[model samples]
Target: MMGRLTIRDRSLLRDGVKAIVSGDVEHLKQIVLTMGVHSGRIDHARLYGDIDDFLAKYAKLDLGSMDLGQIIEELVGLAREHRISVPKGISMLSRGVLTLEGVLAVVSPKINLLEILANRMSAEIRKDFDWIEEQKGRFRNLYESSQKGIRIPAQMSDLLRMALKGQAKVNLEVIGSEQPLASLDRMVNRLVKCILCAAMLLGSCLLCTTGMQPKLLGIPLVGMLGFIAALLMGIWVLWDMHKHK
Candidate 1:
């Protein structure tokens, strides 16, 4: 006696066939979506045009029968034509173990153009895989919900508290003082002034001892000239100091 297939058996058979037939199409759609997202501002015309062109070119060929490597290579070439950059590591990976969600996880460590592609791919994968929803719920419960009340270590907690309370102090002490340089500068200035004064005084005394015949207002002309030069030098030094200040 021939037995008729039950509704459950028919449904299982239909799902199996649908999965097989739609696998390549789903993957291609995911790749296109990822590229659009990564490109930031999607050019809808370019995107749709490319997909339509690809479909038309490969319409005669069974996409499911094509190896994943070849498919990825074609996709990479397409992305390059459109100015999209795919990671070298991702392109090099074998297709047998690669999944849209797996690729997303591998590349989504940071927020970047690549991350946008990863997220888009992940969304596409989720659309195909209903089980991901259940997994996401469990992950959120274990990580997101629980993380809110996570306890910090005592040392770290105390440090954070101190910072929040504005009680944290950073003491910075200079290793050496600049007083020595200032003292040396003052000593040098005084020594220069004393040398100039002594030179002027000695010259004036020598001129006076010589008792030159030429006199200026009853003063020895040479001695008087030396005194005038000394006064000018003092004025110059004071002017220089004031100018600098």
Candidate 2:
């Protein structure tokens, strides 16, 4: 006979569901182990056995036959039979896995399994390549420590180490490249010149509208000709800046 789930079981189920939805396998594993210890339904030995059984079942199937939805339905039925309360957001976890599977289907058949798993993990973590690079230093340190026998899986540790090394290599290349200050200075100068030109053109327009005939060398500055010339200069400056860019 199945036992009734307690409040603790519900809480652990919620956490496990969240981890699944987020694609956080590490957290999921931890939750599973904790739940097993608490309920005596999924100890370490049973966990390994379950994994082996799952893999063995799927090993004979092709990609098309891997019906995730059917598998989830079966799991839900089993949970019900066991008198376990299914966690909320279980649908979200299913959707996330289905999305990952869809992505894998579009990729090259020859794509490495490790790469595919890494991609799925990244999707679950909601982290991008740029974010990884930004935290490269911290990750590098963690990777080094993980080499000394961290509790994380070997594949995950290797992936983290690779990301850190890749980011470091990119940073080194950027540091060795030519400085961009000269280009930045040129851009600032161009922007300043454009603003000055625009200001002059606006001032000329104001003078013309106010019927003030400002002149330079008696050429009737701030008249139609002056406004036109200033406007032309502003446009030319903007065009020049665009060309430089």
Candidate 3:
């Protein structure tokens, strides 16, 4: 018994025949539009010629299948029809025409312009990769320089934070007393400040007291005793602060 095919089966069969007849690109385009031809889908001007006079200019490009020149002329007409606004679209369509022409010449005159352009783009991509490697090398050098005790600029830290994933974060955590002052640092500063305050107050007291006892002030033993006491206290406080630091 013979069986009837479904709509999908018929469409697939038609697509297969179209592919064998036309080539890979046509088959692909047909498949892409199987659902429906979208509105304003094809630029008719790019597909056909719009003017008679302009056709003679590119008679050698084997454009027997496409009317790119006419398309350009029509796009120009579209510009005129739409005034200044149309001119913008006209310029863009003109460029599309040029690009299409370039694509067409990829296989003519015993040359492969497409492959050459591809190779050129490949070279450009490789150059970009090399540039990235050079930047990374410079970053490593800068990081090493900082490790060797060279002062890392504020910018370098920023760069590290931006580029490396976790390097800067770990470094920031491991480095001692970076931003928030440590407990020992705060303690040392507190002790030093206390010692300074004590010394200042004591000196002021001695000056005031000596003024009252001007006769006792001339006594070297008394002055020497006060100086020694201040010195010892300052030194002791400094030593404690240093130990805490």
lDDT of each: 0.58, 0.56, 0.50
Q: What's model 2's overall lDDT?
A: 0.56
**TM-scores for candidates 1 onward, in order:** 0.26, 0.29, 0.18
Estimate the lDDT of model 3. 0.50
lDDT of 3 by residue, 1-245 (tens): 12444576445534532342233443433443342324433433322232222233433443244444344454355334422132233345456646656766674644443345335655765776777688999999988987776555766788777777755433443333333576767776776767775775577556654533434446445555566676777777778768865
Which of candidates 1 and 3 reaches a greater TM-score? 1
lDDT score for candidate 1 against the true structure: 0.58
lDDT of 2 by residue, 1-245 (tens): 12354788756755654454445555655654555423324234444445345445655765445555444544444344334445444544455555655676688544433344435655855754467576997889889997866556876778789897884233343331233876777778877877777777677666655645566554446555656776787788778867976
How well is each residue in 136-198 modelled by candidate 1, as lDDT tens digits?
889989897566656546667998899999999999844333456776796688669857966
For model 2, the superposed segments whose C-alpha errors exceed 4 Å read 1-41, 76-85, 91-127, 131-245
| Top-TM-score structure, candidate number | 2
